[model samples]
Every structure is written in C-alpha cells, then in structure tokens.
Target chain A: MANSKRTLAALVYNRPGVLNRVASLFRRRGFNIESIAVGRTDDPKLSRMTIVVIGDNATVEQVRKQLDKIVDVVKIIDITGDDMVSRELALVRVKATTATRAEIVQMVNIFRGAIIDVGSNTLVIEVTGDEDKIDSLLNLLRSYGIREVARTGRVAMTRGGTIGSIKAEEEAATGRQR
Target chain B: MKLSGARMLCQALINEGVDVIFGFPGGSVLPLYDVLPEFQGLRHILVRHEQGAAHAADGYARATGKVGVCLATSGPGATNLVTGIANAHLDSSPVVAITGQVARAFIGKDAFQEVDITGITLPITKHNYLIMNASDIGSVVKEAFHLARTGRPGPVLLDIPRDVFVEEAEFNYPDKVELTGYKPIHQGHPAQIKRAAELINSSECPVIIAGRGIIISDACEQLRELVEKSQIPVATTLLGMGGFPGTHVLSLGMLGMHGTAYANMAIQNSDLVICLGSRFDDRATGKVSAFAPAAKIVHVDIDAAEIGKNVRVDVPIVGDLKVVLQVLNTLVNSKSRPAWLEQIQKYQREHPLCVSSEEDKLLPQHVISQIYELTGGDATIVTGVGQNQMWCAQHFLYTRPKTLISSGGLGTMGFELPAAIGAKVGCPKETVWCIAGDGGFQMTMQELATAVQDKVAVKIAILNNGYLGMVRQWQELFYDKRYVGTPLWSPDFVKIAEAYGIPACRVKNKKDVSAAITTALSYDGSYLIDFMVEPEENVYPMVPPGASLAELMEHPDARRANASSTFTVSNV
Candidate 1:
C-alpha cells in the first residue's frame, strides 16, 4: 500500500522527560513527525498528544507499537480516518500600515479570524480552524509582510462519540498488559 | 520508621532478593558508602573500574536469572559504565544500575562532578529516572528492579542526587508497580498458539531457532520437549548456545554468520521455522530477503514489537516463551521424520566444522575443544567478542542452559573476564571459565585484581592471537587484506597475571593444551593461561557481508579434497 498521512492520539502520564522519551523514540526509529501538539487533558495527571506522521499502514503500525512501548504512554489510537475534528491555532503578526490595516482586517474577517492585537505597525491575528483554512488565511496575509507566526500543531478529538480506552484500562487492571 | 534514602535503597534491594552489588565509590556516592555497613545482607564487590562493575552485574544476572545491581558515582564513574550497560541492554540482561547525581540544587548549574547520566543512558536503558526527592528513592528502586527483571528483561537505571542519599524520608516501598503501559504479555493468545501448532504439524521440513530467550525464560527443558515431540531439528543462535543441549541428536549447533555448516544448511532447506524468544538478527538471518525463503515462520516473543520487526511471519505468538511453549507442547503431536534427520546428517558429514591438525601450531579451536573435554562441557563459559567467541561457540559442547554467556548483540570486547568473575560470584559452586582474546583481555584485565580481591575463583584463558582477529578476518576477506590497525602489541600475559598474584602459564604448542586446561580446571584459586595460537586463522562457515546463508565461505580444512566444487574458500 502507498504511504498516506496519519494522525495518532496518545494519552500519557504527565511526567518529567516524557516528551523527551517520545521524541527520542521517533528520532531513533527513523520516523518523521510532521506535527505534534501536546496539552493537559480533562484529567490533571494525563496529557493528550495528537501527532501527525506520514507513513504506510505497516510503518504506522510499527510506529504505534513502538510508541506504546514507552512506559509513560498510557494508550494510543490511530485517529486518521476516524470521525474526528482537528483544528490548529496560529498567531500571525502582520506588518499592517495605515493603507493596509483596513484591508488586512477585511481579509481576517473573510477567513473567520479575529484581530487580537492592533499595534501601530502590525496587527496580531488569531486564527483557529482546519489546516487548509489556516493556510488560506495565511496566504492572503503573507503579502502584508507577516512579522512572526507561531502555530500550535494539530489537536484532535473524535466527534459525537467516546473513542476511549476504558476496556484497555480494565484489561490492565486484570494484568492483560501488552 | 524514618530512614535516610541510602538506607531505604539498601532495604529495597534486600526486599527484592538482591544478594550482591558491584560498585565503585567516588565523591558523590560517599553517603551511600557511609551507610553501606548498616546493610548486612548485601555483599558489595569493589571493582577496579565502573565498566567492570556493570559487566560483573550483567554476568551475575545472566548466571542467576536475577536482576544484577551496579553502583557508581557521578560524571566519569557513570560514563565509564556506558559500554557495559549497552552490552547488557543489547543482550537483554536483567541489570539495575544506580548512579549518584549532583545535589538537587546544583543540578543543571554546571556543578562539579556533575553529568546527566540518566539522559545519557536513556536510549540504552529500558527505563531511567532522575529522582529529585529523597522520598521517591524506595519506590524508584523497586520500580527499577521490576522493570529490569520482568518481561523481555533489560537494564534499568536510577540516578539519585547526592542530597537524597543522606536526607531523611519515610521509606514506603511499593509492593506493586503502577505503570499502565509497562505490562508484558505472559500468556500467549490460545488461538495463535493453536495456529502455530497447526503450522508445525503440517510442515515437512521444520527448524526451531532457539534463542537466548530460552535460557532467559528458563524454558530449556520445555524447548527440548517441543523439539523432540515435533521432531524438528533445533539450531541455536550464538547467544542461544546452551539453551538447547549441544550434544543432542536433534541439535544443529548454531546458525548464522560463523555458524555451523549443517545448521545453516538445515535452516536454508527447512520449510517451516519456529522461532522461540529470539529476534531474527541480521547475523543469524544472513540476508533478510534470502533468510529461510521457503519457511513459514511462527515467531514467539514476550515483546510484541519483536514478532514481525525483522522478518515477516505467518503466525505471531506474542507472549512469554515458557507459557507459550507449555501450551504448544500439549498441542504438538509426537512424530518421526527420518528423511529430514538423514538429510541433516548428510550436510554434517560433508561440511563438518573442524580444524585440521598441525603438529606444531596451537589452534584456538583445539584449545577450546580441550577445555570442553577437560571440563566435561559443564563450566559456565564466558567469552569476549570476535574469533575467540566463535571458536568457543563452535568447540565448546554446552549441554546445560545458561552455560555459555557472551555479549551477543553489542559484541562488546572487554566483557568476558568481568562477567566471568560475576558468574563465579553468583554461582560459587559452578566452575567458571573466561575465554578472552588477547586484545580484548587487555581492555579490562585490571579486573583480575577484583577477582583476586573478591576471591572469585574463575579460570581465564586468553586466546593470544595478538590482533583483533575478527576484524582481521573481515579485512582479509573483504577489505583486500589491508590490515589497517589490526595487528596488536601486547605485554607478557603470564607476567601480567603473576603481577596480579594469579597462577599463570603460557602455552605455545598444541600438545600442552590438555595439561594446561586440566591444571586450570583443578586449581583452587583464579588462574590464567596465555595460549599463543596460530594467528590470522579465520572462523569458518562464515557468511560474508551482504551474502545469503547459501553463500557460506568454508574454512580451507572444512572443504574436503574430493568433495564436489560446491564450497567457496576465501583466498586469505
């Protein structure tokens, strides 16, 4: 099978060097991480990571199994083709002059974005949507001399259902560890 | 009761059933040494170097099937243990290494004698931790040992800061580990095992590649039963030497690079390959694509990632080898395969692994065979990597499990002597022999002092070839015999051994091998023998780099005079 884009979600314990362990695993396994976004989940003790990588099924499977080998990683699931909603937030500080200020505001409004900061020389625009929507908004604002852009890589969650690991956790309690 | 972290660490180890610890003290670990006298059950062996301590712990673990413990201070002491730790990790030896870190406040502040040992060993260790609080020491120690000894065993490390050792804390050792992702599969799925049994019953030509997992899992008897019941020819990987009885009728010795010709032949011809607890290393499976082309593989391993990591398999049984094999034994039928056994015997007769006798020259193989004959093939034989290692693997007929211990994966050179010392320390009643190359022996020969000091009565046999023999063989065969930095200069090994207060001898003739080995075997204390064997002698039945198992290069003497021109002899 040909290679395709993959997004994998993992629940991990929030501990020191957990990020380093995950990053080091990918580095040593020769797998490239396209984008990875990690933040605290509903539980304070757990962190959720949505990682986007590109590989075939076998390679992705291998990546998943190897990633699961990390002692800090609680559970992992491939959420690529699943019914999940993913969005990225990007803060673009565009160089807006007197003439281009109104034009940039109009472009942000058209992309369904908001101007969080209005500086004398630049406008800081915060956009949150799918990758394509963010990219399209960035393209229009790029001609206005964007000063800086910082993006939180894709964070995803399945829609309208619970794709959870209650069963795996229960199995672990009974010593069904893999 | 409130106790210091150092005392709690000792208590945790005692609770975990650790008998001995190999370690070296430095500035940061002074508190550990200060509190060591309070621990009555733990016997500490003071090694000459931190590397020796690590290897010794590894050897102890390999011999006893328990977690080996090593201790060292911060900075250089911790760095010195890298090679040995890597050796244990690659070979899946159960070891827990504890290193002292700089004080918690001084950490990341360029403190004196400070280094990130945990970060440095992260890749090599199964798991590692840098505990900031003294309260976490007991729990971390328990966790480290549990991780090191259970489920596809490997080395685990804990780096505790200097302050934590003397700082007082309530020591509450956790009875059970609480890692959600750290569980290992113990029982194989029943359906998968049944399918594997079905594959075994159906296949005509089957080979069992018994690996180190057999010895690690203590399933040698089960493996033998399975092999006999299924009537499959069993071949061992180098590390798997003693896992299957070498003298058994169904045994095809070792298979892979420098493997026995008959074993390699059997593997290439077999229609089914049932791998137990052994990863398909490149050395074992010459060219991955050409490895067992006609065989439908049934791989059984505790780690799930290992099943299809190296080669594709038909039935993948991911679980503990012992549990899997017990169920498999019940399912497999007792059968007879006269034709397959006859074919293997034919290969054995045609290309037997042997050295041609020379009246004057002392052959390494001859020395090894002599040792095997003298010791009754029961000694725990440990070896350094290279030609000496292969010769020991081929010549020593191991009839017991965990009898042959070598650094299989990392191929660490200075592993034998220290590991032998450790094995002797762990199994005091068993006769232990250290087979080292002269070059490798020089790397950590200082550990002979440790052996003498600790009264680890292990006999040392140095195959003094005066060169890194394996690299020389590779250069001769593939690098056009350039011999760049291969030749070695050495001191008088006998004198060196005598300087360390060890009984020593040198052998230059083949006739004296018997007496030398017999003397070493019977001697009460640690002895050393420098066998000046024929240099430039290459290990035979070698699969050259990038070649398939079928393209094996036979030794000049192994190729019979009137045999068909089927074997290729390297022009060395």
Candidate 2:
C-alpha cells in the first residue's frame, strides 16, 4: 500500500500530561509523527492539537480510534481528505552576499515571503504556506547555501463552513429574534 | 472537615467499595503506612515482594469482577510492580496500582527513591495520574477506579508524593465523573447485528470463538443461549475457559496452539467464525494468513481498535459483549448441522486426548485429571506459565465463570502462588488451588509465607518435572535432543513448604495423587503437594511456531518421524 500524509486535529481538555499521553501513544504504537502543534482553543478549558502522520488510510483510521480512547481527548477530526486548507511556518537562514542579496530579495517577493532578520552574511526568511509551497521556496534558495531551517509542522482546518460556523449562524438567528 | 492525604485516600477507597488491599511498604510510603492503621474498614495484606502484591491484586480482580488494589513505594518498589501491571494490562484485568513518590519538593531534584513511575507505566497502564496536590486526591481516586473498571477494564496507576500524603486537604469525593473522551460503545449497530444473524443462519458449518470479553462483560448466559440456539459448536480461548460450560455437548474445549486437536480442526473447517470479545492473538491464530481461511468472520468487541487489527472481519460490531450477545440471541434463528457435528466427532475419535494406563510412570495429565475428579471441576484453579498451564487448561474442566485464573497474555512465570492467594482472598468460601511447575514455582514461592500468615486456604499443586518442561519439549522436538539450560536444579518443595509453617507432602506414584489432594483439602490452612511426574513427557497436538492450524503434530511417534536425527537416534 502506498503511504500518504494525513493531518489530524484533536480537541482535548487542557490538563497536565495530555501532550505526553498523546505523544506516548504514537511512540508506543510505532507510528511516526511527522509534525505536531498544540495551542489553546477558543474554549479556555480545551486545547487543539494538529498532528501530521504518514501512513495508509487504515493505519490513520487506527490512530484516530486509539486517540479517541484517551480520557482527556474531547474530539478528533481527520481533515486529510476533506476540503481543507493547511499551512506550515518555516524560517530559513541563507548565506547572502552583496552580489546575491538582490536576487534573493526578488525570489522572496515572488513567493510572498518576508525577510525577518538580516545579518552581515545571512538573511532569515519567514515563509508560511502549504508544504509544497514552502518546499519550492526552500529549493529555490538552496543555491545561496542554506545555513539553517526550522519549521512549525502543518496546522489545518476545514475550508468552508464547519461546525463552528453552523453554531454561529444559530446564535445569529437567536440574536435577531431577541 | 480537614483530613490528611493518606486518610482521604483511604476514605476514597472505602467509598469506592474497596475492602482489601495488597501492599509492601517502603521509605516513600511511610506517611501513608502510619495512617493506614486508623482505617478499620480496609484490611491490608503485607506481601513478601512488590511483584507478589501486584499479581495478587490482578488475581483478585480476575476472580471477582471488581477493581483490585495494590500499593507500593517509589523507585525500586514501584518498578517491581511492572511485570504484574503489564500482565493485567494484556489480560484486560481491572487493577489499580498506587505508588508513593518522593515528597513534592524533591520530585525533580533526583531525590533518593524517586523514580518516574507514571512514565515507566505509561504504555502498560490504560491511564495514570501523578498527584501533585492533596486536594485532588478524592477526585483522582474516583476517576482511577472508574477508568480501571469500566468498558474493556484494564490496569490504572496513581503515583502520589509523600508530602501529599501528610498534607491536610478537605475531602469531597466526586459523585460522578464527566470524561468526554472515554465513552465506550455498548450497543451494537442494528444493521451489523442483522448482517451477523444472516451470516450465522445461512452458514452450514459455523464455529463460535468465545474469549475473555464474555467473562468480563458477565455474558456467559447470553453466550450459552446464542450457542445453543444456533447449534454452533463453541471453542474458548485459554482465558475464556469458564465463559461457556466445558461439559456441554457442543463445547469443543480450548482452541489455538496448545488447544484440542478437534477444536483447532473445527475452526479451520468452519465456513463462518463468530468471534465474541476475543482478539485473535497470534497464539490463538497459528498462522495469520491461514487461520480460518474459508470463514467469513463476525467480530464483536467494545474496543474499536481491536477490530481488523490481526484478522480482517466481514461484519465488525463494536460494542459491549453482553449487549451484543443479548441482541444477537434474539436475532439468530434456531438451527443445527448434524453433518458438521459428526465431522467434529470423527476428528475427536481419530485423535483422542488420552494417556495409556499401561505405562508405569505417572503422567502430568493424570495429576490434572485427578484434581478435576476430586474437586468435581468446581475448584478455582490458578496456574503459572509453561507446561503446567497448558496441562491444566487441557485436562481440568471449568463449569463456572472466574474459576480458572492464569496469566494468559503476558505469560508471567511466577504468577501462580501470589495470584492463588489473591483468588482465595477474593472468594474465601470457595476452594482455590495454585497449579505450578517446578521452574515457575521457585520464581515466586516466597509468597507461601504470606499465605500461611494470612491463613488463606489455597492448595498448592506443583507438577515437578525437574526441567522447564515446555522449553524442554521444544528442544526435544526441534533442537535435536540437547537440553541446554532447560534442565533445572531445585530445593525440596516439601521442606520449603514446611519451613513456611504449612503442611506439605509429595506424591510420586499415580495412586497417591488422590490421597495427597484429599489431605490438602482437609487442611484449613495452606498446603503444598509436589507431584513428581515423568520429566520427558511432552504435550502433543502442538502446531509448531509459524505453522498453520491444519498442520498439528499429533503424537510423540509422529514428531519422532519428522524430527531431526537426534530424537530418532537417541534412546527412547
């Protein structure tokens, strides 16, 4: 079976050791986690985590079911095959000289990347996009001698109207009646 | 009113309906031990080792469908409970292990006797908690018990700091837990149930593989009803022994590696396999690709992750076994297959499980059969790993649920003595027996002192073969007659039992076996009987590792022909 990348988002209770529980579950099951990002959600008591894993459809389904077994997990959504948008933040430092600086700036502008930091011989570029877009930009800048790179794995959400938007519409109707 | 953390913990346990606890105290648990005496509602049994404490609790839980409790201190003491915890996890036994940690201030400072217990037990435990504050003790205890006992029960651990035990906190136990993520599916899908019923009705040759889940869900009556209604022959996993009455006409005994030859053949020949609550472990399914190859499997389990894990199922119903079996009984129509039953009978007659009475030496099977005859298949039998476990599973008949307690999944060697102690404690009125081999008996025989001191009337039956029989059987079959480290040197079990202040006897002849058991049963306290049987006798009908269930070595003569030159060339 061909392995494909999957993005799963989970809403969990904000408590101590929740992250460890999720991470250890993956480690124990021998599932390699590509990337994981966690942050507090709109609800103060709940936190949302985005995990990028590489496996077949069946393996990913098993992971979702196993995650649902955890007491601290509130909900899990596999947004991989859904109509969704994903973004990854990457900061890359490239060796730039007076001669290559202008060309690098033009390449960054083409990709809509921002120059976050400038040292005497290095320029730190911040890029946010889907994995392919980031990879393309990184590839274009490799000739300038890439010094270092750091990426905040992929975070994703459904593209159009979701459950949150449906709730908002219900609240709006009640507000009009009031 | 304010109460110390230890007192609050004791109160929480009492509130959860806990009456007994198995524990071994250490430096980090001193504060809890000091306050333990005040709680008269809870009785504590001091075990010889932390491992024994854990296994005893596990056995108690298996005997009774309640959460068994065990306590230990930090570091080495907590680490000693690892094997027991893993055993309970694998078997889905409800056990709550409480470990005392270093004081709060010394938690991360590499304090003496401080080990990351929760971290060590992360994979084995269903869930674990580290209590940093005394105020959360009540709710944590409540949650731990609820988690350990509810839907697909498993082991849970709670590590408390020493300072937390001494600190004062207001005790307010929670009335109900609100866990959003841990909802277990109890009701099966109506469509799936209908599909399963259709498959069961249409199939001419059908077999039911009942597993530990039937016992865990307390669905023995539902299972028996379903089997009798459908007229499907039932084969139980090792842990599922008592779920269906072994003496029933349609019962095919245990299935898998060391299972009955007829049972394994019936499964292989069946057109439909209705798996209830039992995950098809590698031991149960000889070779994954060839196991029940022609059968369309209907698997029902509470845990969704277990579905399609090892074997693909045609109709998968994720729900509690009791509810699923209840609904299934109503949906399934009455039917019978005389041809299939006749075929199984033919298999049974062709390769019957029998020992020749003409042999002068006493066989291990005779000992088990004698025990069964003496107890009328009513005693709660607990066994350690290896040949003794397989022999007991084969020869003894279990008529009631929770009657056979053994470490099935983890295969812990030293489980018999401590677990039997726990089993006796759980059901004081019933007769409990620990059937162990010489190798495994020595591993945890130290717990005999605990049994004598506590006055637990658990009969000890040691099948002393002088060698690690199961491994020796393998060596005899596969590794050319060389024994290697399989042979053992041991102390006299009789003297050992006597030293522990327990009555002891030895039975070397077949005729004396019954008298020894009768004498052991007569004693009100613990008693040990060392039954010296033929060391070279092997368990037959073994499906060699990686072999298909269809290919089983039926007897020693059959093995000798296929075995290397070693067995055939050597003296019989």
Candidate 3:
C-alpha cells in the first residue's frame, strides 16, 4: 500500500461552479490533491481539468469513481500507468546579484528554460517539462535564494491511445486501458 | 403567449404532474405566491416553518415515490430547509427545493434578507441552479426535477432571484433533457452478474443485505424472488426494513447497531454477502475491516462511487436494483439452505428479539407494538431520531414498501411530525402514524399547528421517556451513568396538542396504552397521545462503537438472568 502519484484528466461541462464541485468533492471525500490545472478543451462547451493526487491504487480508483459521479464531469481518464506524455509549466524567480546572474543563466540554459523577467535583485525563469525537470531546476536555484515560484500542476495525455473513450474510462480502475 | 417567470415555473410543475406543494411565503417570494391563485390545479399547504415544509416534502416523496416539492423565501427561510435537504440527500430521496433570492440588483450588497443559498446548499444537493435570467426558468425547473428523481434520487434546488420572478418571458417547456454526464447505469454488466451468480452458487452460507435501493427501484418483488429462489437469508439496513417482508421465513431483521442478534450473527457467519442498492454506511458495517470477514462481498448499486467506498467488493455490479435483480434472478442457481436456515433458527431461539414487559409501567416497545397491533401493521409509520426511532423499527413489523418512513441517514430529530404530515397528505386514504420521543418531539412541536391547519389526520404517538433516552443509555453504559444534558424539561405534550386543536390524551400505564391507540386510530381528524414510558429502557443487542458485528452486548435483563451469555465487559 505505497502511495504513488496519479494523474487524471477530466472533461467537464464548462459551467459556473463546476470547478468548485470537483474540488469540493475531493476535499469532502478525504482525498488529498497534490496539484490541479484547468483549461478549455477543443469542445466549446467542455473544459479539460488535469488533477494530480497521491494515494494508493485502491484509494485513487475510488477517487476516479467519485469524480466521475459529478454531474458536470463528462468523463475521466486516469493516465497514471499508461504510456503517456506529461508536462508542467513553472515560473520561478531567484534572488540575484550581478555575480550570481550568469551562473543562474547557465543553469537555465542547461534545463532549456527561458528568463521571463528580470528585476534589480531577481531573475524570473520559466520552465516547461515534467515535474522532475522543474523540481531539479528549482532545487538548483534554492541555494541562490529562490524568491517566488508558481507551478502549474502537470497535465497529461496518453502517448498514442484514444483517450476519453468508454473503454478507457471503464479500464481506468482496472489499470489496463492503454 | 408570454408569461411571467412565476407563471412559467408554476406551469412547468403542473405539466410535471405536481398537484401539491409544501411551502411558506415571505418577502422575496411574493411574486411566486401572487400567481398561485391563477393555477387552480396547484394546491399549496402553508407550513408553520420552512423546515417543516422541507420535511413534509421529503415524507411525501418517500411515501409516494415522486419528487417532493418545497418552497421558501430568502436567507433564514432557505437556511431552515438545510437539515431537511440534507436528510433527503443522505437517504437518497427525490426532493426539489425552490427558494427565492433577493432582487438581482440587490444581490451581494448585503441586501436585506439575502443569503448565498445556492452556495450553502451546493454540497448537500445533487445539483443546484441559480436563475439569473427570466427565460431560464422553465428549463431549470425541468432539469431540477430531472436530476432530483433520476440517477440515484436526491434533493435538488433552484434559487430564483426576486427580479426573475416578475420579469416576463415567452414560456416553452422542454420535453427532454440532454445531460451527457448524468446517465445512471441501469443494467448490470452480463459478465459481472454471471460472476456474482457463480459466487452465490459456490457459497454454503450467504446473507443478502437488502438496502433502500430495493424500495427506491421498486424491486422488492424481485428481491423476494431472489431470496426464495436462491434460499439466501435476508438482513436489512434500517431504511431497508420494508424491502423484505419482516415475517418472511428468510428475513433476518435489520442488521448493525440496534439490530437483531440473529441478524448480526448471521452476517458475522456469512460466507457470501450480497449487498443491493444500499451503500455500506458506517452504521451498517461495524469495524469495517472485521465486518463479515469470511464473506466475499458482491455489491450491487446504481452509483459506482458506493461500490468500494466502505468495504471492498469482490464482484461489483452497478445498476438499478430492479433491473439488476431481474437479470440476477435468472442466473442464480436454485439451492436448498436447510443447514443455514436451521442454524439461524437456533440463533433466533437462543437470542430472541423481545421486549421486557411490565404489568405496571408502559415501555416504549409496548407503545409501538400496541400501535402495530391496533393498526394491524398497515400504517405508514414515521419516527424522529433516538430511542423511539429504534423501538419503532424493532417493534413494528413492516411488510410493504413505503410503509416505514423515518429519517434514517441524517438521524434528524423532529422529522416525525412534519414528515408524517407530508405522508398523510400524500396518501390520504392510508393511516399514518408519527412515533416520536419526548426529546425529539419538542424540537419541532410547532408543526402540530400545521397538521391541524392542513387537516392531515396524522396520528401522533409520543414516547415520553423524560430524557434523550439514547444518549442516556450510552451514558449509563459507557460514561458511569453521569446524566448531564440528556434530561429534558418540557411542557405537557397533551396540553400542547390540545392547543393545536387536535384531540389529545396522555397515557401513563400499560393498560391505558391500548385505548389511547384505539381512540387515535378511529378519530376522524388528527389525534395525539403522550405515552409516558419507562425512561431508562435501553435498545439492546447493540454493536458497540468500533466493534465488529460479532461482538454485541445483549439485553441487560438477559445478561442478569443468563450467566453464560456473551456479554463482554470491555464495552462497559
């Protein structure tokens, strides 16, 4: 019963208070959410939400079932064990002087990140990758005194399989859809 | 033709076959009330409080299996319905609550009598809507009804601002709703059903824990068929009491805390547990990990979320109860359970469900049984929370669906009076009985006025225990008998009932209980009786908190009389 990171993508009716309904359900049912992100899907009436939570497989399966119970949630796809592509966007600002700026720039280059903002004493770097690469860059900048950071929780889609199909949702709990 | 928002909403209700509603009128909902006279087909009962309106609507829904309707004004009015809505939500009753909000322009400015009712009811409701425009009135009402009655029925709410009620709009009610996300699975997967049948066929000792889903799905006939065909004994949850006939040879009365000893033992010894339509609520499954440890659970429910929420299921089937049972019946092999049934009969004989009778004092069980005997087990019985609720559940033999309507899940006190009123209103030809405890009776006794005003003819029986008996029992058993706030001080219930213009009487002795019940049952209008009973009586065969069903505390009298009974001192 080891806790593992689970990524779930939900297609939901784009309506007022829909996000609140989904989030409130997770909190009320005693499920801890690690991170979550929301954006409009290709369908105008539907929105795609990527949710990251940490729990054992059974508990996460219960989570997927409960989330699917929401009337506004059109579908749920758990890509945790699937062959999937995932990325996270993070904006990190590290405290900097002229002496530390070039070293920070080199670290950003190695991580393939861009300097999004620059202040007299702070350098804001933007990175987009899986959670690990961003964590690596942030860990590297911690010694230079990281000032502010905002991380969009990871969003995921399966590698080549059809997502959101009836078969996919049915097999999510079984962990054999892909 | 164009119609005001109020007219459109009323028309939609009429089109949906709603003939009656329970409500209280106030400032913000004046426009809605103003148009009530035009709709002569609609009848509204004026309730004493918004809470009573909600409970009445719930009672109506449970008794009739239709969507119960309740309406209230803004702020306090809307908040008052919270408990009733939550009660319906937990019990999975179909209810639609309509609340009027402050004028659109006045919202969010701390306007008088304004509150964020939709937000307040969000978690408690299946779904809720806030009517921002007048044109959306018909569809919102349509969708609210659709959601409330379908897909594991629950309470739904529609909060309309005052301006929306008066604004004129062309009204066209939709005949269909297109909710892609809300399709409730009705048919069980064929393979899963076959697997469940194989599990059942392989088991030597099996127990079918029938739940409210059977009644809600109108699958009691199918349940009877399955039980008779499969030769499986049935134990029920509190709300599932009537799903299987209490007098059936296969029936093990309600299981869990305050359940029959035989039922709990049967479950503890079961090899296979087939749960239908009922969620594995904590009350039903004591010490979850230890509950039915030897059994492989096959859970059949309409909601997928309920399958593994409490106990993990081996063969999980999500479908409507009737639809599932119909298909399940054809697959389960016919078997003889002579050994299992004989073993259960031995358990019943050793630990029979009985009440300690007294020649001088009236017990709560005596009052309930007399009502059962007098009504011939044909009344729609409603109960408030606590000891009276348990006694009524135990003493009365419910053989039909929709006959026992009580607040099961939320355990709300004072649900008895208003819900009985609602049940009486919905089924006027049937006898309705409201059995309440003194502590719970005093909570919403004001609804006595509503009962009299509406001429509902509901018979009221108050088990006057002088204290919150259930808490007192717990305190006596677990807290060294230090009676704190459990003792209640209240006025004479007979006088209170008289003030409401209902014929009332008080019964203090066991002999007087029968005549009082007889008088109430035959009375043309509503009647009330306050039966002063033994205050310290406790509901026995209790599965102690966090104790498995195998560990039960038998009756005190039995423990004192029988030296060899399994009464554990650790619970004390």
lDDT at B89, model 1: 95
DockQ of all candidate complexes: 0.63, 0.48, 0.45
Query: What value does the lDDT take at residue B290 in candidate 2?
Result: 99
Q: Tens digits of per-residue lDDT for model 1 on B360-430?
A: 68888888888888888879999999999998988888888888989999999999999999999999999
Model 2, A79-111: lDDT tens digits are 888888889999999999999999999999998
Global lDDT of each model? 0.88, 0.89, 0.88
The regions of model 3 sitting more than 4 angstroms off are A30-32, A95-100, A118-122, A161-163, A166-178, B559-572
Clashes of each: 0, 0, 0
Best by lDDT: 2
TM-score of each: 0.96, 0.95, 0.95
- Model 1 per-residue lDDT at A149: 94
For candidate 3, the share of real interface contacts preserved is: 0.68
Give the local distance difference test score of model 2.
0.89
RMSD after Cα superposition, model 1? 3.2
- Colliding pairs, model 3: none
Q: Interface Cα RMSD for candidate 3? A: 5.1
Candidates by DockQ, descending order = 1, 2, 3
Docking class of 3: acceptable
